[model samples]
Target: MSPVAVILTALPVEYDAVRPYLTAPEEITLSDGTRLERGPLEGTPWTVALAELGEGALTTAILAKQIINELAPEALLFVGVAGGLKDDLQLGDVVVATKVYAVQGGKLTPEGHQERPESWHGSHRLVQAARSALRELRPDVRGHRKPIACGDVVLTDPDSDFAARLKRSYNDAHAIEMEGSGVAHAAHLSRQLDALVIRGISDFADPGKSAADSSGSQELAAGQAAKVAIAVLRKHQPAPEETPGPIYTGDHIDFSGGTFHGPVIGKQSRP
Candidate 1:
């Protein structure tokens, strides 16, 4: 089988975690067929692009589409760090997104769509496969293997109200993060066929904690997340059975009375 294409912003810690599993590609090419001249992980098929912090969903989506056009990879994985929405999660706890929710677009009312932030989609089987693989290898790595919370807008804020809103909006989500929704949106738009967005909570997102204070913490969490994502890709082949699951339907979600109010309400979210 051909190699599954993976894309991510080269956050140092995450690069280190999955470095061991990556097979360093032989040549390099950009979406436009222009050769990438320089990068830490250059000259390899498993390429890394520099998407500095806060590089919103639209930018991320463009990059993903580029990869799809150039690489045409079977699968795409977005591995990164996220703020822990749940209290049980500490620094380094991994939360695999059972679904990616983009809350940027308009509200999805049954009657019609209301104005909201722009949003996108993600892969659950990839989440499950990654969790399964991680458990198989490092049982110590805690896997909050459930539907994860995601959005196109930045969920990072230094307030409890934001956390409360996240909790209220995405009741089924175990954690919240910034990049998953954007990357997931790119994959969905480009028709990548199969895509995955996996994140780890580096910080608990305590209203009291400063984002800088938790830099080291988030990196460690991202490292763990990268490990699980790579393991999932390695062990699970892209078979028809392997890829079976629901279509992604969300971008910043809201669960009211145990009902999903995003793009697609998943079974896991219902009960």
Candidate 2:
């Protein structure tokens, strides 16, 4: 069987950006009625399965596992838009997450809220493929391989407590999003699968986010992210499937008196 890769998105815009890159898409309805599209990724040797898993880490995690189990893909990628956290990242810039931080796990103490952070790194092979893909991207669309912080809240205030917590604890994260950590965790649990998260900076996680969305930044960001994701797929080559040795089902002959020239293989032998 050809190698398969699953691409998941959290929003319709993100899904739309990636849908165009698929050819001969056929819809697949899960047992729970969730729909997905599976097709060959244009210009690549991979069969891509795409789904729009609505917002939230928990929901994405559950659905991602279901999809993984159903499709048994070689790799999985979450492609979408995120709020930029770094000063240098601009709208439409793509970020390939080297790791995903689950920022919501913590403890509330008498002194203050204490953090019990959990994180999962992206597949090293996928990260290297993404690095190579970036070179083929447009010069204006900058790509970064950095950490991403994932949480449940839609962070729109730079001065908010959550934002401060992120700044203090996840200082290395370049982007904030809702689902990367969940997907990464699920992928990690699937020992045989590889996973990555690719996001485009749609806003700065500040008061200006609304304005940026109104100006169509989300669409642009989603498109840029989708491009990089497909490019990564092109650069990545899945491992070849092992060929099974020949099977002999006939009644085996006794080799006690015969001088065999080569090794004999059989399932059963009769004297």
Candidate 3:
């Protein structure tokens, strides 16, 4: 049977933002002890397979591969909050990644570290859907389509040496987050799985993270990201199963609901 999509989240806050769209939810337990919340999306033809996969690219890749093997969702969308890397992206804005850069790849040489970035492009179909959905969404919600850097390190200082290294190789990135590269890699390996990474800006990638959190930027950003995702979902209509074809990937999101008020919702799967 064909399922709608696989929605993966890194943190509980991110997971919570998208949970409300799933109705008639079911809980499934994997052999590895990871639990999944499976259900049909309200007013949509998709059965969303949702999970909070924790953090980091390694774990996310492993778990995403496992989920794809089990559910085989038509698309895999990673929703979460990220630190703003570009000046135009302010706290609470949304960013849909055109590509995810695995910035941690490289080797430390005798003189300095050399960058060897691993990148994965967002599925073209899926991304187009997001762009279409963007047109239908309210104009005031700031959103941008740009590249995002994915690394294991949490950057708190834009003036740090590590930040300098990132700027040298991936200066065009609009935001920074963890686990996007891992999920994109898993989708690449799957060949048929369409993957996208969507993030809400929560901080400036500087030292004032705690202050931002205290000011509820994370929550607001999360909700904004979720809102944009839902818009994509509303506009996206899954293509019918075609004759087995070549590599075609991108994000396509469609949303269905009433007014455009922003709020976050999600489910928790437990043993």
Q: Evaluated with TM-score, which candidate comes out highest?
A: 2
Off by over 4 Å in 2: 246-271
Clashes of each: 16, 0, 23
RMSD, candidate 3, Å: 14.3
Each candidate's TM vs. the true structure? 0.68, 0.90, 0.86
Cα-based lDDT for every prediction: 0.60, 0.92, 0.86
Task: Summarize candidate 1's per-residue lDDT along 165-184 as a digit string, tens digits.
Answer: 56656666777666667677
Kindly list the per-residue Cα lDDT of model 3 for residues 144-230, writing each as its tens digit: 889999999999999998899878889989999999999999999998778899999999999998899899998899888888887
Candidate 2 vs 3: which has more TM-score: 2
Tell me each candidate's RMSD, in Å, in order. Answer: 15.0, 5.1, 14.3
User: What shift in Å separates residue 220 of candidate 2 from its native position after superposition?
Assistant: 0.5
* Candidate 1 off by > 4 Å: 24-27, 31-54, 106-124, 151-161, 208-215, 239-271
| Per-residue accuracy of model 2 over 28-91 as CA lDDT, tens digit each | 9988777999999877789999999999999999999999888899999999999999999999
The stretch of ten residues in a row with the least summed lDDT in candidate 2 is 262-271
Ranked candidates (lDDT, high to low): 2, 3, 1
Q: How far is candidate 1 from the true structure (C-alpha RMSD, Å)?
A: 15.0
Q: Comparing 1 and 3 by lDDT, which wins? A: 3
Which of 1 and 2 is the better model by lDDT?
2
